[model samples]
Target: MGRARCWRHRSPRRWKQFHEGCVPCQAVGVASHDGYKRGDDTVMVDGGVGDSDESGLRSIDLATLSGVLRVCDVELLLLDGNGPRAAFASRVHEEALFCSISCGFHCRGRFMLPPDWAMLGYLHATDETLSWCHGVPLTPGMALTVMPEGISEFTLSPGTHMTLMLVPVARVQRKLTELSLRSTPPAGQALSLFNLASETTPLAQHYQQLHVQLGQGASLQPEETEKLLHEHVQALLGAGAADRPGCSRARRTHYLIAQRAENFMRLNLRRNIYMNEICDAAGVSERGLRYAFEDLFGTSPNRYLSMLRLCAACRSLSMADSSRRSVKAIALSCGLWDLSRFADNYRKVFGELPRDTLMRAPAQIGQPA
Candidate 1:
């Protein structure tokens, strides 16, 4: 068995960002001595820069398959060779968005998205190849996005290096409102409620166009680009989250803990919350509090607090007379210090801009009959 060379990222900042954004982002510095084994399966491996001299990256060997359905941000930078392949699948447990740019790589993979989302995909490749499905063929350089009833499939070949990003839209909107002080505008203001697949509005189309144009240009700065893309992602998540109603189901233990945490946050979202403070209030150790929050909400204490503030902001947006009070003031009251981020998150989660949410009169909460 010949040893494969390892690949590790040399830049520290980039490495840090990659790890923070995609936990378990490991760089195999180089692939092991064994070259591509004919049979091996690993769903994910640590991320690294281009391959180094001494080691080759690990392959997703077909022998052992491990997958976990959880909310995450994943970025894969691969230098592919001949006869390489990776296959992924999920049902009801994931809402995944993938973007593949094949400078000179190829393979095939498929994906399934949660309902209420029209599948949106962007695939860029060197050779003119196509993915034909649902009675349509997506040509190279031409992006293929589908909103299948429930799921979709994908394929890649050797020399196919791509980036795939996935987000459960249904959960996105809820987290958006939870994270920022903004309300989703009424139906009239929203261009359209999310259906699986159809022509998008002019405004939505424009965003995609601009993004593509910028991606092709060399003048666009990576930092600025990442910031903008991150905002777009946040907005997408928000739109995804808004499809569901709030605080519906509740359990005894989970309810009490969530309610207590939420109430405590409501009282102090305007102020920065410390993890220890939350633990002290919940009568649990810091680790215990952190674990509970992640288990119940799929987020950390700080993240949950931010979401609470956003939730309060959403409630207030519909209740308070926004004509007189500005959204900035509302956000400040909700514990968010950054107006720009608040607005961005507001727009992302609610499917409409913040001003739109405030333009109309406040709404009254429905009373139980």
Candidate 2:
């Protein structure tokens, strides 16, 4: 894969400020690589720079049958399937996890959001679907109702393409207050997932169009994004969570455990810790630990831990003095044992190597001469 060009960021403060303001940032850039085959039918694009934080275009490459992409900062994951199964996820700060996906999968969890974000989306099938929302079959178009929370399992059939936009609750509430209207923004479970594609409503049609644009890796303008959020909130306010207030107590317990575990992970990022330690810290059993992680992260504890540590290492590299410490030393401090693998993963995610980032750090902020 070819190396990506990076802007010289002067300091960690600049990085923080840039990311903090980039709520609707673009995902763009392309790097080709040797294909790695998995099992019998899956192949991964070996090494590639997915996008730069300051890049103007959203991803140049589309995830489809012809090409496979595995980018890190956007947290792209393509699971093994008959063909290359792929999904793209990028968070707009702490407000949301923006997702564009084309895959057939099954998930068992309820979103454990921080009470400030609301999940919204538009989805349709390229072929027939075996998809279900809550307990009912989710068809192409219909009037919607609030779905009960803590669904046991949600399934999607092959050839399902969708766009999920997570809007902060504060944004929705503010929008409603501005219009002199008010409605409860049920945390995505109690609103209309099925009728998002209904042809009868202009709003639904607009959602489909926006979803298609997002699938093509187009960035919505700030105004347009706000409009979409407002539309979703207005629709949701019509149907509050109370309509489907039959969430399982067991699932709620899982969410509580997951939140506690996440808090523990954040506080102890500097220290290398294990799953058992986290379980003890959260006061949850092994099974509850598994359930908590799967519900919140959609992955295992080990994978999530690695991600946290890697991010911590990146922070150090972005702010530390190269004269005082080598990349290997900083990595070891963050519990990363392999230098070669760390550089590769770091470049794939951030579009630059550790040394490259350190070189860009301003002299005034890093170390005492």
Candidate 3:
């Protein structure tokens, strides 16, 4: 479908030439937790999870990241094992002309994402693997996906960061038409240029530049933002899809085993759940356990378990009644002693110090005013 009508521009250069990211000479917004607005259609929020669920599962409020994202549409990426829980932080900038998005979280298990909007995305940095449809892995860096094409699944390593480069649907449609991508007129399918490396490519360089530009938080004209997205789309359309192999049944079996292991791990989040313990519970050999986790979740058993514990701790701190609880007390309950280590891990996963979450709470809840 077409987007809301906006000012038009002559068709820019095709994929060969490179263009720097957007340039915003005038100010349009400010950076704060409340969010910055450029116009009636654009709103950006800088926020994180509001509260924690019973299982210490903290749902990320994507609206805080971008006004355009619906909380119902964005799924909760599960942390399947007995470990820490995590929260996500989103910086959303949705405007009449284009959108710039960045979000990060730490989840130590396999999770599913719903087939939602059609947009081009890049895995700026991840220790995990993202797959769509029949396990067609999306390459890292600046690459485009029809997004909903395959069954989209992702296993985020501890503290994985993802950023998206956005263009208006109008320009996106025009670019798609040039490639003759067979997804029909209005709604197009995810497409890519094959054999493209995520690093050392023009796409990657362009993406990084945009990342910096957005980071600047400068006020911008709609055309300045629109051109960045338009040029990026041109580059994607210029490339062709590479050959990709399908996920095998054997790999699927390992995944099933990994899922089982995750369940066992989740149960032991409050205790030190050793690899050997996980192996016994999942009915797989030690080596098999390692392979399963690496294949399915993209991290070794220990790393994943650590992420679970850290996230769970973050929730406890966020929800702690200041009067009755202390950071050390909460950390201990999460089986995370060694206050120094706990503090370090907390900051790494959550992007804030543990004391910050504790201090941010309403004084009447866990602490006296």
Candidate 4:
């Protein structure tokens, strides 16, 4: 039996400290003695954390294997010795890595990895073979990875004990492309250039040099980091995750006008501004502003102004310097005279009592690009 402890670290300091020492693993243990069949439609494990962070790590004896699984997305699993070992399936077009950071028994003498990805195994052990259904050339290393366009599969010897870190394709690409050129080759390609015997390759050396130049001890420069963020956003967009369906041209035009109007509203949110004044501020006719705003944001200009005021009020409530401001004061300053309406709208949109959510939510919130 393997002992398992599950903990959730929420505080930035605590999470960093915990991650520094943790080793991740993923396993599909054998259900029958022969060691060649799926265990069950639903496998069970002893140690898994609940959603809440306050539960902390509860030390327990774990005789099974279970955690999170994604049939089509990436998952990070932490496996120890006493878990099931079965041929588990990975999601389609998903790349995975099982890095052997520690433990000797889990090592494999040699194995060919698939094209889109690779997995890490120890270099000394014998008797296990890993494979993928797809066509990908495998490489042996302590830091094995699968490319988004490749495969990930491996086998291990009996009584093998190892900890694995599953690296997703997106994660690796982001990490690599962050510091390299936009058109850098995939890791599998770059790694293949290395002479395994010597652990030296032009690509490896170049990558290491770039990593060091970006900051050996500190994080990357702001511009470099922003470039990486833009890449990630582009990747997400490529994945078709950013598109908003059912947005008609009229709707889009209306939205653009509303955005401009909202900008004007924010500039004058603190002052007494009339509807005509807002129309003048937006440089559009009162009827046009109303029609444009209605088409775009699905709200009246008057109602939008009210919502903006409430948004400002909520911001004030959540502000660190809000200790001196009352909710009523904020509402009145934002041109709203009704506290009940403000409270109601606040609760509906944010899903919490205004007071309770004020300090708990993030102070600097904005729309994602």
Give candidate 1's whole-model lDDT. Answer: 0.38
The residue-level lDDT of candidate 4 at 350 comes to 40
lDDT of 2: 0.47
Best by TM-score: 3
Q: After superposition, how far is residue 250 of candidate 3 from its true place, in Å?
A: 8.7
**lDDT tens digits, residue span 1-369, model 3:** 111122212123310111111211111122334433444323343343434444323434211221222211222233433223333222323432233333234332221222333455555654426332223343445354443233233445444434454334455565556556633322243444233465667666655655555545544444544555555555655554342224577676676676577668767776777778899888989889888777665677887677656766665665567668998888877778688998886665555688887777546443322
RMSD value for candidate 2 = 12.6
**Residues 156-224, model 4: lDDT tens digits:** 433332222233334545555555534333332322111122225322332233323311111223343
TM-score of each: 0.30, 0.48, 0.50, 0.33
lDDT of 4: 0.35
lDDT of 2 by residue, 1-369 (tens): 011122121243432333354212222222233322222211222122233234222222111211121111221222111212234323232333344555533322122223334456655553322444443344554323222222122435545666566555567567756654544434433455434424656567666676555444344444565766667656655544433234356655665675567558867765677888889877988787887566544567766667666666755665567777788888888777878998987766555688876665434354321
TM-score for candidate 2: 0.48
> In angstroms, how far off is 25's CA in candidate 3?
22
Stretches of candidate 4 exceeding 4 Å from the true structure: 1-252, 320-323, 338-369
RMSD, each candidate, Å?
23.3, 12.6, 11.9, 21.0
| Candidate 1 ranges beyond 4 A from true positions | 1-257, 362-369
Model 2: which ten-residue window has the lowest total lDDT? 62-71
3 or 4, which is superior by lDDT? Answer: 3
> Once model 4 is optimally superposed onto the true structure by TM-score, how far is the C-alpha of residue 336 displaced, in angstroms?
2.9
lDDT of 1 by residue, 313-351 (tens): 755564466545788888888887888998887655444
